[model samples]
Target: MKKKKIAICHYRVGGTDGVSLEIEKRKQILEKHGCEVKLIAGSRSKGADYAIDELEWDQGVVPIIKENGFVYFNRKDLEDDELKRKMNKISDRILNKLDEIQRIEKFDAVLIHNIFSFGSHLAAAKPFAKWVEKHKLPCIATHHDFYWERNEFDIVRNEYVRNYMKKFMPPKSKYIEHITINSLARRELKKRFNIDSYILPDIFNFNQKPWKKDSFNKDPLKELKIKSTDIIVLQATRVLPRKGVELAMDFTKTLQKKIDELKSKKLYNGKKINADPNVILLIAGYTEDMDHDYLLKIKAKAFDDKIHIKFISNVIKANRAYRQRIKIYSLWDIYVHADIVTFPSIWEGWGNQFIEAIFAKKPIVVFEYPVFKEDIKREGYNIISLGDELETLENGLHKAPQENIQKAVQKSIRWLIDKNLNKKLEENFAIGKKYHGYKILEDFLVKKLGL
Candidate 1:
């Protein structure tokens, strides 16, 4: 029985992104079940067997002629020339890559991530969708964000985009297996296109060892100029508007006050139950999208509340190895070192931190987003759900040995480290290794794609 050839497509796959993370986990799962995996993406992913053209948006040329590679837009102001050029770059890149692949690496199936949802690079993605349709190749679109739902789409409403998003989607999208990360996305996909998609929520590599830096973990506080006594609560994400970084500071203030109270309760010369670890809320994310006013606003909030937030972006780089001489570190590195993760996102197509926290098995506080209610809340895992207004925030920070809260946090972190939590990490391992891991190249080969 010959195996199937699968191509997972997306942009900027290497770093910590929801689409890439899910694709990596899923690829690992499928490989174990026997699938030969190929990658057709805008960026390079570590575990991929083959690399395709860089996504159109990732190319420097597109952004240089317009916003000079900035993130997100300020309004619905559409720049027709800039957008058309962007679309052209994306189309050419994908068409060239597809042509090359057709000449050589014949694919059995294609798995797309966020391409249809973010149509900036639609010229490329839409054509690929059409190719998949024409060839009758088994394919899946693991949607993280859809066009209608994204705020960015307000800036992209030209003919080049409107055609693919409104027209191409219904006609071509229905041909592939549609999957989305959150219920809201799924419902919208169905409501708009009548496409029945599998709700494959995001997952982490629970089977792998926790990502605590070997020697670097010894004194992250010292290296980051943080005091030893500082309680390191981290907001592990890219510096973007939706992450709600302001809430993390507010939460930190509450925790800091609580710490002072705990210290006061201790008797003279007595052993304290828990020492007040001089609370310090360090926001560890890339400050790419922060404008002067936004940064000023956050600083003002902290100033008003007297919260000290050490910006870790200077040290956090885009890639590992700090290879770029930029003292750069990834958000994942911060996750492994932090005492707690503060993920207060206003909106996310899918929450990457939830899975990263789960995989790292760290105690996390996730702010309520539609994805939280739509995708992960029902997953029977234990996370400090920040549903609305810091519901579990105070409790998860201080309350230990309690039944509901303590037990749940313990279960999630424990599940990451202890393979024996359920019927054995073996079942989880086999499932992951089968459907998304070792046999990824094989599973889709015969069963999913008939390669």
Candidate 2:
């Protein structure tokens, strides 16, 4: 029997972002199930089978289209008529490239990630919708995010651009099936467009070899200049405003004070708490272009509070590899050295880092974002909660209540000192494996694609 050929499409692939990680997992699972998978992307740092330049948002004329369509309609740079002309030209190029690839590869199905739902690359959406329509191909539009959910895309400068997004950004078609990462998004998709979608939660391969102190990843602590006695609290998500990294800093500061008070007391693991035991918050994810200033603000707060925070995105990548003779560590490698993981995102389509912490078998301090409340919390995994409500600061950062932060800090200290810490971690790993392991994804794909 001939295997089914499937193409997984995205704006960018082979990055440390959640979407890229999810795509990689799906690709691996699909291949394991006897499907020949092809990765199609606009740009990729590595591992894309087909890199179509026109499909990327920042390349060639796509940025101009983005600016004129969503940012501002500066008539002096390009009139409305000319803007449409350029949009069509770029769309045509993308369509032509996709058509050429389809003719050669003859993909049985296309799994698109974020092109139709996200508003960033407006031109690519129409071409993909058209390509699927033309070929009558079975397309699964996996929406990681929607335009209306993002503040940047809430307003459109061009009327034509708005209408185009309404029609083609997730076009209505019989060949296309929509999937959301959470129940909240599925409900929103239905409420907004009357389009029902399947909920495919973010999953992990919990059965993979456990991340341990291998020779390549043996000294992440030394590389990051962290002491063996210090508690390493990792914030593994990208440095975005919504990630609520400031809350992690706040929790760290409070936890540090408690550590100071408990000097000479034995920790749960039988290590004596030093008078000045460091609680370093290591941020392992790269900062996006829009969130550079947000990172600066986080740094400023850390400085004011005298909290030790290390920004090590330069040393962490999606996978372990050498860059410029320096050994770059994978996110999992960093996880191996972490004592606790902080996931305080105010909003998320789904929590990837939360699942990652579970797989890593580290205790997590979570903020209970809406999706978590709706789709995840019922699973009964034990985690230190930062509560659901947030208080907005004058600097525009968010904070958990003082009591909640203190409560979480106390729980973390208890967990850190507990001799049975491994037991709790084992429970989390078991629950994650039971619900969100690769088997779950395999079952879904086998049913959805009839593989």
Candidate 3:
């Protein structure tokens, strides 16, 4: 049998973002199923086979295109006509580069990630759709997020850009199939664009060797200057407004108030809680490009509350590797050190870190976001949920209700001290394996490709 060559395309690949991580996972599964997979991206990163600079969100003409099209229109700098021209120009460049890659690779199908649905790189849509049409390529458009879901892309600038978004953002064609990461997104796409899509939730490799303390990962705590006795609450999402990291700080602060009470109890690992233990929130995700202000706001709140929080994205990479002779840990490596994982995201297409915590067999404290409620909660995983409601504080940060926070804090302590902690974790891991393991994704791809 001839191997199916698949090209997985994204604006950025081989990075820590959910889409990039998903691409890697899908690539691995596809290759495992005897498909030759090639990674094509807008920016250069580890594991990218080809890069088209114009497709990048933050580089080349993309930012300018986004400013004129999605952001406030700058008529003085780039008029609507000029902006459209520039968009078309970049689109052609991308098309040409993609065509060149196709000529060499002769891919059987193209699996595109987020380029059509996200408003971040509008220029790539038309060219990508054109190339697929020209090649008669079977395309799987996987939408991680949509423009309407984001406030930043609310203003469409003009009718031309609006038309482009409508027509080519996800161009309707017989050769194309659409996929959404959750049921909500699937319904939303059908409701908005009348486009039907398959639901492919985030998945993990549950059968792989467990992430544990090794020589490479053993020093993350010491390197971060964190005490071994401190209770590490891991927040493993990128720094963004919707991530609701401030809620994690609030939870940690409330949990810190019970340090003395914890000191009297034995930890799940059969060790006593420290006499003066600190509940540290170790954030191990990079700050997104436009969310520096949000990061600052979170830092300010942490300072005011005196929450012991550390941002260690500098030491975390997409995979374990050495940079400049210094060992950088993967997200999984950090998960090995986590006593509890906090996934307090207000919004997510699908929860990657949540599944990761379950895979790592660590207790999770999660905000019951919409996707979790609609797609994941029904699976009956054991989790410390922050309830599905939120209250906005004066500073514009969202928080779970006071009672819910206290309840979650109490449950977290019990999980930390209870000798039966592995029972709950194992149950959660089993549920995750049943619903979201790699085999689930492999079967989906096998059917999608007709292989």
The most accurate candidate by TM-score is 3
Q: Which digits, one per residue and each the tens of the lDDT, describe model 3 over residues 60-86? A: 777888887865444346788998999
Report every candidate's CA lDDT. Answer: 0.59, 0.87, 0.88
Regions of model 3 farther than 4 Å from truth: 71-76
Query: Which stretches in model 2 have alpha-carbon errors above 4 Å?
Result: 59-64, 71-79, 261-275
Which ten residues in a row are the worst by lDDT in model 1? 394-403
* lDDT accuracy of residue 314 in candidate 1: 71
When sorted by lDDT, best at the front, the candidate numbers are: 3, 2, 1
**What would the TM-scores of all predictions be?**
0.72, 0.94, 0.96
Winner on lDDT (2 vs 3): 3
Worst 10 residues of 2 by lDDT: 67-76
Using lDDT, give the best candidate's number.
Answer: 3
